[model samples]
Target: MDVRISVIIPIYNVERYIRECLQSVARQSFSAYEVLMVDDGSTDQSGRIAQEYADRYSRFRLIHKENGGLSSARNAGLEQAKGMYVCFVDADDYITEDYLCRLYEKAEETNADMVIADYREVEEQGNIIVKELGQPPRQGCMDRRQLLQALTSVGECHYATTVVVAWNKLIRREIMCRHFFPEGRLHEDEYVIMPLLLECGHVEWIEEVVYLYRQRQGSIMQSAETAMRHLEVLQTYQNRIALCRQLQEPELLQAFKRAYFWNIEIWYYLMRTRYGVESSRLYGVFSRRMWGALLRYHHVFGRRKTMEYVIFAISPEYYLNQYFK
Candidate 1:
């Protein structure tokens, strides 16, 4: 049978988790798929573990490169992928047995450029924290307008933002190749996923919990040293806002403002609690941007949140205290 899907696993120093992750992919019920294990110069035994799988499985290919970053590794996999559809799976996370089968079937059924599967976030010890994660509010095949609406709607706990993540979607190889992940950037998913979705003429959402995302403490998203880098999200959202304006999408523009504001609000609290003096300096810069966006799109903020952000602009400490106290 011809290769139908390519599973790209970007490996770093995830020796502790690599075996389990690879095993999950190897056991997928779907048979017509190839696995590309891109080892980004791992210092641990991750490369060795991946090589063993490659040796054992004829379809598994191991490619090694000097340590770049997550984006670099994924791009490397993309360079060598032989399948029509591509699915990204992080080295530290595993998937359910039917993950590929379900996503592939959905894409075929809907003739979609992308198919998004729901996931579960779990602790390292195997306890699930969030279930049915990343389900779009709407189900079945969605057009570009419907998909954008679901993605831009930042209200009600923001259902589709988690779907923006790379690992949970099966994308047509050509669509994914249109916009590669931005190398050397944190939150790189923010840079590419939305743009890809916007370009897709057809997209589909399935409710199955296929991917299991591990919420580990020392990972890039959780580490204290890299936490400050999340400020990059502000710039990412700004780019999205510009795109909305260019597309003449007032609904998207307004929704992106609320989404942008929500992120800045989060980063402000994180910085004040963790970085102290540096937080104040950054907050001054962030506050100006926040106020500017709010002025243009304040209709999306509503009365209560607008008042709260006003307090945040004047006295961050006072606004933060409302949460702590």
Candidate 2:
């Protein structure tokens, strides 16, 4: 029988949450699916729990490997996936029973290469914080231009929408197979999401909340290492800027330049708060590059916004603490 969807879940030491996550997938309303449980050298009971599911469920297949990172585990899953569409789910996170049903129906309806759904971040105690969309305020089919606009949009629209995340979306296997996650790297999703979307001739968004993301203490985003690893975002955005420029896409180039500047501020704050680094030291390093960017992309910001950035460049600490406070 041909499987409609291949769910790729990278399992590590998520012993505390593995059963719940697997149970959610097992009970999914959509049955024409196979679950790929790629266990990345888990020392805890996570592997055992996953194996139990594999033994009991005909569609669940567990593959164990050495302790590669999340990206490596996901790549392993992709290698073995045989379904038309692929879905990524973190081992520590689960989904709604209708997650696959809704996403698959939308993909088939639109003939879309990719279909993204809404998700929510939940406390370990299961308290809901807020519901989020992969692409917000816009639904139905999306053009490439629209996708680029959303990708480079300001503030919460970037990561808060979870558009940069791989797990919240259902992607066609052929398109996904062409690209692999960057191994042993943070922000690996950021690197892959853009390329994946750009490759899709048809892309779509749905409003249903399908994935439940758990915010926990030891999670990658919550770790102190997140501060240092955030440096990786620079490479991702730089590559994006180059791609936009190479494509002669002036609008996307402008958007990426604007996003690049915004990212500097994000990095600065994280460095200060998470790493205990002083703002003064960071200011010296970032100000020079920011000035260069401001001059190079002066047309993008115009008079008022350029002046704001100039003032920010002059005294980022004061501007951030005073205005952002």
Candidate 3:
């Protein structure tokens, strides 16, 4: 193979972290891999920094384009990728030295369409370790249905974090290029991950922790609850539910509905309280939309879950002062 893997790193105002991120790619034990450092019109020195790496190393490829979001940058990288397998690394996050080597090895060994692994989350300051996330993809190759089950937490204990997230998986390039990232979307992964899983025949799981995800203070994940991004998440989950129906997986449908109920419950709680008060217009629209959705999908909840949602949805103030206090 000319290139076995193409590792994509989408850049945007990540000058602070881009060097570490690129250095990690450069240090990977895997030899037959290329790094597509797609700079999304970063005003900072990020593109220049990446350009320096591309200038120094043969494997590092710098792609500079106008200001588009992360998805657009990733899309550009994918379009120009010439590898059999593709994996994504966020501009702010980097991987372990043997990350690509191990993942690629598993893909070839198991003849898997996708290979999933574990990751670590560390706070930005002090390089202090916050915790390790060992969300299992289950050891061994999984069929489409099995992967779906693992992803949605249908019969499992909880949802696997690796399922919805774009990173932490080595996907076949053919399948990746077929499903382009949605341009200008907040939670871009939500639109693609499950569908890609459904298209795959086998997904290999391994215990090795290959990625180090940095937890920054002002990241979108942190502000999701308070900002309009909460709306994006709900929309994404609803899309998942619809995908389940399209697949005719009643089991998955029921499971996702249960998940959806809790998501709504939490969003409702947030909106009816302090965090949601910032944007009154958005809050009002979100409240009405969720209220309607709650009534429509009410049957998806069991008696207990319904009660749980109603308790918070009906009276967040009481719950906050009493139950939460």
Best by lDDT: 2
Off by over 4 Å in 3: 125-128, 132-137, 143-146, 150-159, 220-226, 269-283, 303-325
Question: Positional deviation of 312 in candidate 2, in angstroms?
Answer: 5.3
TM-score of each: 0.88, 0.89, 0.86
Taking the tens digit of each residue's C-alpha lDDT, what string does model 3 give over 152-193? 542113236666678889999999998898987777887888
List residue ranges in candidate 1 displaced over 4 A. 130-138, 153-158, 218-225, 273-278, 294-311, 322-325
**Per-residue lDDT over 4-46 for candidate 2, one digit per residue giving the tens place of the 0 to 100 score:** 9999999999999889899999999998999999999999999
How would you order the candidates by lDDT, starting with the best? 2, 1, 3
Off by over 4 Å in 2: 131-135, 158-160, 218-226, 280-285, 303-319, 322-325
How would you encode candidate 1's per-residue C-alpha lDDT over 1-325 as one tens digit per residue? 5899999999999998899899999999999999999999999999999999999998899999999999999999998888899999998899999999999998998898999887777888768885443445557876666655555544324356556789999999988888899998888987886689778888888876788888897453344446667677678878888777877878767877777777666667667665543555666666686677667767886698788887777766667778533
lDDT (0-100) at residue 281 of candidate 3? 45
C-alpha lDDT values of all predictions: 0.81, 0.83, 0.77
The deviation in Å at residue 76 for candidate 2 is 0.7
Q: Model 3: how far is 180 from its true place, Å?
A: 1.3
Decoy 1 TM-score against native: 0.88
Q: What is the lDDT of candidate 3?
A: 0.77
